[model samples]
Target: MPLLFIQRALMIAAVVSGLSACSLRSSPPSFTASGFVADQGVMRVWRIDDGQQRPLVLMSVYSPYSGPGTISTLYEYQNGVLYQIKRTDADGDRDSIQLRFTVNGTVSFMQRQLATQRQKLSNDDIALYQYQARRILEVSDALNVGRVRLLQGHWQQGEVKLCNGEVVKPGFDKQAENWIARRTTNNHQPVSLAWLDGPEGRELLLVANDDFCRWEPTKDTL
Candidate 1:
């Protein structure tokens, strides 16, 4: 009789374990990275490339030890609503307005709805306003750092606008490459701007104060 009782207990235990495993399997996916994990709810994100479909980047945050981690993610469009949800550890709550996904290793940037902003044609206006706007967006997207460090690669000597609206020209000294580009206007002060090499020196990469980042569109639905 003791042997029969033991067998019945083992059978019940197996059934309970199986049910628990099934429950966990049905739960939502968790976004995990080094020293960070984001538990997202009710949002389905997908990854697509070359017509193939997969789960898109679901979670990204700045690493605690390193500089701010930039993660970019793409979401599915359901009924014309952007469904990408961003979760982070900094706020101690999930962020609904801005969501991020990992594209490459430890590098992510802010993406905007291209439909919102007007792509103006004036170089001077772009240099002043547009460049700074993009840079500010990048800073906002960054997780931990209030002011990010700029690593503007050297191109050539040129004139630039400083945060104080002072037009500072780089003389023959190539070592004066370390400077910040102010992104916003204060007391009618002009936002700063910098010029860098672009495409055979015909084009220029404008670096200014604010968050200027690369946002690439996703091509698939998963």
Candidate 2:
């Protein structure tokens, strides 16, 4: 079987096991991060939740190894109901979408931008966006329950310096560690690394020379 297929199978199993475990917790963390592999890219998700496990905000960054471009989406919920969704593409066209929903799940505001043009979204498009927002929330909840974490940091001398300035060695497998080492070998500029930590194991998500911190969303910004 393919590696991606195996990973997906393991993730599903984790989610199933976690359903029982999550119910036992009296209080869950207010913030969490997780990610998964999409068709041709990797998606890193950050979530902020109310103490009762109701998500307040969820943001995801999808970076394709080869294809169109990177896309970032943000979902905001009010009283456990999704109220806003924003998506941006890092392509030349700079396509973007923003939608705001009312408490009764009706769309209150919607806009789509492509380069210099602004367009109105059809009812079908609005429905699709709403569907995607809910689906992302479900996936994020499963990943959080499964103890899957997404971590990103700056790579320096075989150690990772996290956004908060904490430097530590992550528990990555030999293959992943080797890949990082190989990529950073003789590189002068700083490299950014993103990876997944899950009950199954650690998986490398990205290693690029880009400055990830500049664009990453913080609690205040989110």
Best by lDDT: 2
Candidate 1 per-residue lDDT over residues 3-121, each given as its tens digit: 23223334433443443443433322222111111222111112221222122232222221123323332232222222344323332322223332243212133322223452322
lDDT of 1: 0.27
In order, candidate lDDTs are 0.27, 0.78
lDDT of 2 at 28: 44
Tens digit of lDDT per residue, candidate 2, span 1-222?
A: 012533453565466456547544645478887888765677778888886689899998888765567888899989899999999987747899999999999988999998889999999889877876766677777777777778889987778998768897886788888888877888888999888876577788888887878777666777
The Cα RMSD of model 2 versus the native structure comes to 3.9
Task: Give the residue spans of candidate 1 off by over 4 A.
Answer: 1-158, 161-188, 194-196, 202-222
lDDT of 2 at 34: 80
Q: For each candidate, C-alpha RMSD in Å?
A: 24.3, 3.9
Model 1 per-residue lDDT at 138: 26
| Candidate 2 wrong stretches, greater than 4 Å | 1-23
Model 2 local distance difference test score: 0.78
